[model samples]
Target chain A: MLRSPDLVGKSQDSLREAFGKSLILLAEDYPSLVVLDADVAGGTGVHHFRKNFPDRFIQCGIAEQNMISVAAGMAETGLIPIVTTFAVFLLRAYEQVRLSVAYSQMNVKLVGSHCGLDVGPDGGSAQCLEDIAAFRAIPNMSVIVPASPIEINQATRFIIEHKGPIYMRSGRSPLEECLDNSYKFEFGKGKYLSRGSDLTIISCGVCTGRSIQVVKDLKELDINVELINMSTIKPIDQKIIIESAKRTSKVVTVEDHSIIGGLGSAVAEVLSEYHPTPLKRIGVKDTFGESGEPDELACKYGIDQVSIKNTIINWLKNETKG
Target chain B: MTKSVKSNVNYIRSLIVSSIYHAGSGHPGGCLSCVDIVDYLYRYHMSYSFLDCDNVSRDRFIMSKGHCVPTIYAVFCDMEYISLSELKTLRKINSRLQGHSHRVAFPQVEVSTGSLAQGFSFAIGESLGLKLQGYSNNVYAMIGDGELQEGQIWEGAMFAAHHNLGNLCTIVDYNKMQSDDLNENIIKLEPLQNKWESFGWNVFNIDGHNPNQIREVFSAAMSKENQKPSVVIAHTIKGKGVSYMESIPSWHGSVKLTEEDCRKALKDLECTDNEIEVLMSA
Candidate 1:
């Protein structure tokens, strides 16, 4: 992942840090596992793996296109190479991922750090808001966006085990752990953080933590809302979403990415096709994010706890199915 | 005195032209330019056999300039990887042979390449993987002069050199012609040999059309003595064997190969009446 220089918060708190730490644990199980980087090892959080397994760490300089295809080639030789870089920079080699890795059906895993507006202060260029849409468009590509560090750790192990081309993303901001030690990552399944019957709040990535906080606060106000952590975006957890929608009759989705073609779009597609419900998508409304603090960007984008709570209160009071 | 090699090369050239003509559309000039290089590697230098194809340790070939897949098709046909009848179905609907390399459709292809410079990077990766796994297998990739214009080529070049990929040998079919026009006119890559050498590569300049030179250079490049990747700049005509299409930019897959054109091109390669009939019917 291409990471922007300088950090306002402690790097250890971010999902990328956990992703980097997870690689070290993964190295013990998979000896043939290699991590390819384009000068973003520290930013993408694979530095721990680099220090632990120098032989398996490939420093590919700043050539993303070369790194991706090279990983595809490595996969052909029975070595699983995790191609990690910034989400936006990975788009630079989308063609390579599509043809060599996905179309070839090579056993390669793609990890993108700083997936959304969670990449604070780096400005609009560094913040990759469209990666979800870009990656999900390609066929044979599995997309995963882990909500918390705990989920990313579990998700990392799951992606390595599931052979084929997969794209997993982590936010740049530090997120509170919503899942505990008993958490086990499942394929195409959404995890319910809390249960309720008033309304369902579906979220992924950094938004899941914020939605969880909003759910807790809403519970205090007697407006109980169920929270669903949608980690897998491609083969989405339609069963959980439809069931929640059926129970609550109202669904609101949130993410740190663009409202179009992201978690919101995917949820809308599933609900409209399978279970019709009153749904509202809470995210950046088709606009580029500027250089701002992490919390400021979240608040301004309407994905923060306060914004989500206010929006949900209004929607719950007004929105009704015919 | 390589009698069989000579006849096999001619037949490969004939297959390339006839297949393009049969499909009504295919890249001819670029494919013909790199035909001898691919044929020599498959026959003399590489351990790639049509018989024991499943051997992973066998030397691998990556056609980075995937638009020239017809070259690999013709070479594979001569090697009996696929039948002559299958070769005739190239670029046709429901055929395994696509306009470019599609590994999903044709499992024989190592990597699907139609875009430029990607196959070169792929070769670098495979080279690294083989070296890490302690296998002696080498990865041979062929690119065109025009493909050097892509940024990924330089990106891969730097990576291959930085990693010191000794098991990787890349050949540039420096025919100097792209789809629209000449390389110099489109994007100049002059002082090209210097570029590779400066990138820490073992560079060699040779005539791509000469069978002996192509085979010898590949043999020499297989050495891990220098512990560096090697690049061969094979200066060749855009269309080497087919006289009607040689050294001309328009023939660089931009023009369709009609039945008359195919027969004329096969005659230039000195195919006998029986050989020509066999190729036409197949």
Candidate 2:
């Protein structure tokens, strides 16, 4: 296990910035590494890569479908093309990603930034709560949601080295750094932050940070809860989840996505298939997200640290009483 | 055109007709319409060796209008990419030849593209990729007149031209007919040449069926001094050789061909009885 980074006094950083910086560093070693972006180069933070490596960077304008298919084509000729755009806009080219990238099994990395309700003020149209479900359904496609700037940077290096199709979702706002400098990202493994026997809190992406904070508070209250940061949603860490389910006999999944097919649904599928345990999935119900502050949206959507803490406390109390 | 090349085109047309007829389903009209252009590229223009399909610097062809891929399968069979016997197994259970192009099953296919307007973008990328690696090899992509209604085609046109991808060439099979009606009736693409020019491509218009015109336009597009992508607007009939299927919009997709219909189509292509027997047996 990697040592946890000190949470206090550490400035937050957006995952998009980390992704852009990582691409520039990755291009140093991988000569064939190329980055393609839609008109959202600035928004997705690939503008940093473009300024440094203009020869390797392609501004694909506002056309996501073309960017995706072009990335697939570049991949065909032994190039690693990382395509980026807003999460919601990426779905506009879903068929291109499905057929050209995923179906062909091309070595293309798709980075969808500004995912989930955290993309505040852009409202329901911009927030992509279903992206996780949409990408997970495609075969040969690996889905990863990095919880912090450090994790996103690690994921960028990992995906550049890994072959095949991958979709990594990142948030618009800066997130608290959760992983220490020593954390190594494995493709299908979840990082265990805290171990306890009473209950397991499975989470991913920005919610993982929030869940960890909540779990720390619960520990002081004598509520022993295990926190598992499940970054890889597809090909999920089934062993860790099954073991945790058997150990705790109870599980709760939190994500800044739709409850139907995001991390919660993924955990539920595993537990139900292997060792059935009492499970609770905390995420947005099937509904659109309205314009609001990112923090306000997180609380309203029931993925905030306070809501998670309350839900766990209530569930644990109910179980103990029964 | 040489007598042998003419004969090869006819053979490819026959293969397309027979395979679609045998399968009892497929887009025959578009397949027949685009056969000559595809044949011209594979026979005269493309640089891939018959034995080694993995040549990195070899010319790449993307069938953007992939539903009409029976024509490409016929050409591939002639090229010996796959056995001629496999043509009979098209769209069959566990067949390598899927209903649409399957890149996994057929490694020679650069990308699996049944979706319209997407393959053209892939070709643009391949051209860019080759260019970035300092390889001067060309990439050819074929699109249907009707498939131009898709917005992605214009997006690719803008990107390819903006990047000055001189090695990228697009052939629009301007067959006039689409799935349900003429392209004009579905969506007006008139002044199409100007639209491509405005999008920054070197546009060439030609009679799609004329072998000499096809060769000349391709040569001119390749040898042009301009550093822009080229799009050859090849005007073609919906169905070129077969009499009853030609220029008919309803024949855009599958039209059930009776045994007599197959016989007449083959006769129109001047297929010998022995050739017909071989195709039927396969």
Candidate 3:
């Protein structure tokens, strides 16, 4: 079951909404679990957690660095703190994350909502395109991007149990379901959504959701695309990536983030190191996004299905010529 | 009690002087300035001693200005949290005592902080966490006056007061000098008391080096009847006891202390022959 039965009829739900619900649900089991926000409760969708657990929810006003710093302190007192904000703004405390959380190896979960182009009309400032690069660069920090609302639910629970520092991104735009309720989210593991031999499309975050549709559509056209959801960016699933790439021969990496230092780069690093394979990284090409509809931005930024299809089509033509 | 505090403070000063002087590089200027306040808290205020950390009903202390961690090691050694031999390994390779305090290296440090203002911010969170657990124990953090220039301090100032965290107390060692130069040249923090008051903290002004004043100020800050966060601004010279190092910007940190420097520093703190031998042992 690619899609959860509960979300079968539902057309769309934002990743942040599922993240907030998962946080509230996880709080019952882990009493030490607390949520900290930088006055972005509505944006990051933690207002429900704040409302339900007022004693546990700490509103740090508009100070992101303080929110991060304080969360590190909370972690020291045997409490698990999830610090939330828009992805781009999370970098404002990059130094704090480096020192207080990562360098110190504190048990703090950093959840950045509004990741990448899905941020839509809010533009480049709000869209957190560089968080994957920023967080994964730190030695002790793990980066996770959930493919859909179901993945977010599972990933949120996984992070609460996982100790040390982690950066998990949630989205503002509605994400279609990709994983069923039975799906278990594991750190540093990739999921094989569908299988084919023509070429592999390794995608992360919402791109994984879209790639599911692309692989299905391409199967009808006899292209036979292999789709793997590479959600965990840092400590990436190297085994799955190499195996899928070797079987398919050619690999296309897709993400809602930039081409540099993201899912594309992670896959490229793995393939280029151990298994040399022809690969194309499909994402925003070294440019800032602008104010537009998410669908328009997706097409302009070349992460849309039509753009990925055109790329795969060109690659197939090149293969025929070879 | 004041007389005992003065004597213990001098002993801790000798410990700091010997350790930093042996390490060849450490911040002694701000350490000397802030030692009395921190030393007083360890002796009279904080409930838990590092030697007896299993006691959960204890107050937490955060050293915000971490470069002066030699002073913390000195206090810990003087209080017997760690042995006098470990106190001599201030900046040694693989020593628990780092150039900047790290909790991993030394678990006695509640939070690892060399980056300014962030420790105070963490103190606010710890206070909130304790409140959530229904523990009335307080969280105390000390920041150098120059460290107050960091924006996160003010953010924490606003946050602690707004939440009415009466268990949270911040001691500002107003030694004035920063990394490169005096704070007046870097960032003027004039009307500093009014600034904290404006942020809604219960502000108390005191002389940082005076043992009696340090004790009296904390009593008012620690009073349970008050219902908001407290800030004790202890104004003092950058390097108080040492003659040449007093208010000298170059002695602020990482300045190698020669044999003569250690000898003179110990002499300045008025350490007797027996005290100097004990301080320099191992």
Candidate 4:
């Protein structure tokens, strides 16, 4: 006797469609292209590439380590390889990525599905909240966190053309469509959803949508905040971050990963080295998550909009006190 | 080839004994084993220059078995890739000739290969990239018999075969011993030729220490017209030159070169003080 889950939301299906659309666009564009997935193809949204080009698609069947090494070899042999699996599975192949791909500077794209506590219900083992932080630690790696389905497709296209090792973190659930076919996408540029001088909210991936809402909620209290979508985590738009820090002088970094080494740390590293602005970090505080709903986990880990806004308000108050 | 064989063997043997004696530590067993193979490859089979080591279009040789680098340093010194005087500085601090071939220190070397199962992939990548860029150069990767156990080596093998990478040739020093133990006891890799042939590779088996067999097998591998990747499994001894150390695993990484041992090896090489003076001067 299993409980039937709610299907009332319009979000989850959009993520699936967005991921599929991106793969289709990639296959249409690159001739020397191939996709490799472990057993979880449907979960990773690589079914579109499998459907369109069965011959080019490789189902490596539960061997993530072997899949990554083979992908590196394929990339060596001039095939653009896109490998997809759960975030934990990607970590299983991290050593392969480090030596075989990154050390050799091979062009292979790794797509990590079900990233963060957003995975929900499958528990701490399945969800990979530490993925972005772990991936950004690797040198010469480009980390992309797509906010919505539209960005997932765009990120895929951009990664295909960018010519380096790419890690695209795709969420299990979806959000409001952030981009359209008419919308332009750039690799290393952070998009500004809102502009203000009082405080800057720099975030990426699913956290970007929440950070936008946090700014909106704060505006009702007369706190104007700038919102930045720092999607490319490595080779990050450091100039934009530095400029935002200098202009606002108050910054709040938010993400769905560990506060120790994720987006918060990346931003802090940039500011600590350069501007040294007043900053508040919002993310999981050095702890593993448990089985729960996505929103419930967000609340439990203080990842919701109210907590983000509260952190910003407290930072401002603390700076005034000093 | 026949005229240079006795001299090359004696020179490589003396180099192995002296270099290890000077270094005080090195994998002498494997290096002594692979000298004739490397000698035949560089002297007669492969095309390159000793004068200008920076030739862009020359064939590339990668030492996948980096622990057995006494052979490479010896051959390169014999061919003047570096000075024989520099050879005296093997395994010393700040020496160009380290325990492994580093591309940063040596320009002519292709990939820095201390890590196993990776050199083959780099060689394949370089070969494919060179071919794609319209360069008429060949890539040769020399992998040790025991190192074939690495999974990435198989991946490289599959990629090269599937892509029909004719420009790539891999040679295995199948000495049947690795690291003071028999390879079978560690990881059994038998019927080696069949294993490679099934992997869609054109396989050749040859007595690795025999100069004529080494050259003939390399030529046969190159003659495959369909341009498929080829593997030449060279059957070799662990330590071929020194009678006391030959085929013995204990001598793999241990240094046993006393002054008496050096004198004995030098006497076996049949060199005069004039040749030693010439070696020292140039």
In order of appearance, the predictions have TM-scores of 0.95, 0.96, 0.94, 0.78
- Model 3 lDDT, residue B219, Cα: 83
Candidate with the greatest TM-score versus the true structure: 2
Q: DockQ score for model 1, please?
A: 0.78
Docking class of 2: high
Top lDDT: which candidate number? 2
lDDT of 1 by residue, A165-198 (tens): 9999977777767777687778789988899999
- Per-prediction DockQ scores? 0.78, 0.86, 0.69, 0.17
lDDT of 2 at B5: 35
Chain A vs. true chain A, TM-score per model, equals 0.94, 0.95, 0.95, 0.93
**Measured with DockQ on alpha carbons, how good is candidate 4?**
0.17
lDDT by residue (B164-202, candidate 4, tens digit) is 789888999988998858999999998888889988998
Best-performing candidate as measured by DockQ: 2
Better of 1 and 4 by DockQ: 1
- Higher-ranked by TM-score: 1 or 3: 1
Residue A12 Cα positional deviation in candidate 2, in Å, after optimal superposition? 1.2
Off by over 4 Å in 3: A1-11, A319-322, B1-6, B52-56, B272-282
User: What is model 4's interface RMSD?
Assistant: 5.1
Q: How many clashing residue pairs appear in each of the predictions shown?
A: 6, 0, 0, 0
